[model samples]
Target: MSQGKRTSQGKRTSRGIRTSQGIRGGLLRRHRDFRLLWCGETAGKFGASVSGVAMPLVAVSTLHASTFEVGLLSAAAWAPWLIIGLPVGAWVDRLRRRPIMLTAAAVSLVLFAGVPVAARFDRLSIELLLAVALLTGTAAVFFQTAYSAYLPSILEPADQPEGNAKLHGSASAAQIAGLGSGGLIAQMAGAVNGMFAHASTFLVSLLCLAGIRHREPRAAMTGPRSSSLVGEVREGLRLIAHDRWLRTLTLFGAASNLALMGYQSIQVVFLVRTVGLAPGPVGALIAATGAGGVAGAFAARRVAVRIGTARATLLFELGLSVFALLIPLTVGGAGVLLFVVGGFCVSAGVVAGNIIKASFQQRYCPPELLGRLTASTAFLSYGTIPLGALLGGALGTALGIRTAMAITTAGIPLAALILFFSPIRRCRDLPTSRRPTPDSTRPPAPDGEPALPRP
Candidate 1:
């Protein structure tokens, strides 16, 4: 009888090990809906990365655009965050997120395809490029806002870290492929024709989105039909302002983006002109440096588990970013590795920090307010990007590209000071929910979900 019992226990233990191994293989292998979402999002990121390299190449090589004009082109791509970011968040919360994403993807497809068509007709101009970038930027704002809200609906809180890590990791890998191809495409064909590649990726994204099996239910209406959009926008802003964690993260994101974009806006010009690299080598170098994002994504969950999310954020965002100062030291031949090392560290830190923040926000924020919270924080953070681009242009023109790179890179580490000075410094793990007072009247979450805390 004792031997039989031992045999039975051993069989069960073996089965459990197999089950756990299957799960460890990841969501991409088992979860169909998330798999589709990941594929679509990764494709979209790949196209965007290609465009990032191709667009500037077209301006600099074909149009002979000056330093400031190149910066302005980068700025146009993000300016929509300042213009339409706030309202889009409220609108995303009020509608089905998937349709919004689909529509945005379609619009992007059309807009990107138009660029090549214009080039074929000998009608491509800097103004046309700027307009295309601006419109595409508008589409991106809607798609991104909806996508952030949609992910939480499909994923349980426990699975969110894995989901975020997978998505971010795959996106990083796609970016590497795209950036390298963008330069090669420009080198082999004309830079103007590269838009075809950008347009096609959106088609892949569109098809994947259309094939998603899980449908999101209609968003819950939180207020009267007559509620003003302005009021809703204000509510999002107030939530970020009042929540210490949200406030600190948002502020840090804004400051950090300002610095990040500042250097990125002029990096191509720096590499081509100051570093004297050809267009092909420039793209290859950028793509090589971006590999760090994959590493960061792979390690984020483990790092958070070992060191706590709050400490991981500090280490990733601040500690790794100190290498930014190496970029300006880059020159020809072996010296170019300096830029690669600096860029790799910065990319790793930023990607890891973003994964941590995404998981934190999805779990911490009230479900109904997630859209608004996403939008409000993005508005503040991404809004600085255009200004940063312009600053890079202005500084490059005034001081020099090398000097501008130095200044902007220094700010990457400095931005993390906000995190150190704020409530985050005292915490081990990020708070999962706000503690309600004794007399609180907030209702409990239905269906055995965690309780919704006060914002």
Candidate 2:
């Protein structure tokens, strides 16, 4: 072959390689709609994190709320998942998700801003705080349900893991920033003023959402509408109950959340009253611990690829949770490192596990049923959060704060037992597709009983 001809072929190959690499650049850079969505979601997460610290601080410092009341405050934020989760899912399936998300964001902005307004009027009572939390939480429920279903429409099946990882990673980073900022803002001006920061983020999110170019196609109505809301909800529940993989993950998630929320509900009180930390330090410490989530998010895709998703789930969710016991051992000065380390592990584990779960659901479930699937599973998993918060508050009241922390932390690792006893333990990778059940099959292994056979 002629040397010039060989060189020309090499140049063609090199140009092809360059084009491929350019296409493979970060999802945020390559996809405009997804980037907008990511920005909106991350901004919203930052706001929530700020309020997570500020709201409780307001209750403790300004309103002089008791320990149980603080726990109830936390519970109020998650209680909507129990009350309206099912109906919300069915509704999301039927509607254009972006509008629902926009409305929810608008509602949240008003609600958070109302806090400082009420404070200015000398009407900032614990009762009012609870109402704000409750209302914001309700908005969150709608936003989240719609958001989950809408995501698949924007990204291809292959790109989902990267998308989930980027979203989760940025969210973790935003949480760290927000938590730290919440403390400083509280110390400098006051906790009440921090709500302004929280409210402002939603405005950013709203603008980002508005900037997105892609519009989801309206959900197609097929045939005569035979299913009532209740019937649709039951279909979602039945899907989870019948699918062993879904059932295992959902059960484990519920158990894990219970334990997680249990300790988290009283962490502010423990740090303030027991660990002898100021409000600023409390937020900073929590922010520091959240760095683990950032690590988890960055590592999730690689870890899953290296170890398989199912095994990665166990390692992330179960193995890493063992460090949670260290949080209860925290004290003044250098002993605070114990809490940091423990919280880091727990955060990393949860985030990584979530990435795996999110990718799985987007890939495994039918697009039409994704909304219901997300809602039903979340209803069970997140529903336990309020119960856990109340339990933590009750335990802290009955036992010492330290004792309550220890008890709750123990449950974190123990909750993984739900995974161990189910089908997840026997497989390496979680199945990418669920097997179809015949239309005539009996309603799956009634609720709690395992349904699908081992992969």
Candidate lDDT values, in order: 0.85, 0.86
All-Cα superposition RMSD per candidate: 7.5, 7.8
Best by TM-score: 2
Most accurate candidate by lDDT = 2
Task: Show where candidate 1 strays beyond 4 Å.
Answer: 1-25, 221-226, 436-455
Number of backbone collisions per candidate, in order?
Answer: 0, 0
Q: In lDDT terms, how accurate is model 2?
A: 0.86
What does candidate 1 score on TM? 0.91
- In candidate 1, what are the lDDT values of residues 21-66, reduced to their tens digit? 2223467887888899999999999999999999999999999999
Cα error, candidate 2, residue 281 (Å): 0.7
**Candidate 2's TM-score:** 0.91
lDDT of 2 by residue, 1-455 (tens): 00111111111111111112222337888888899999999999999999999999999999999999999999999999999999899888888888999999999999999999999999889999999999999999999998898887777665677888999999999999999999989889999999999999999999999998777666423323336999888888988887767888899999999999999999999999999999999999999998999999988877876676777889998899999999999999999999999999999999999999998888678777888889999899999999999999999999988999999999999998787776667656665555456832222321134545643
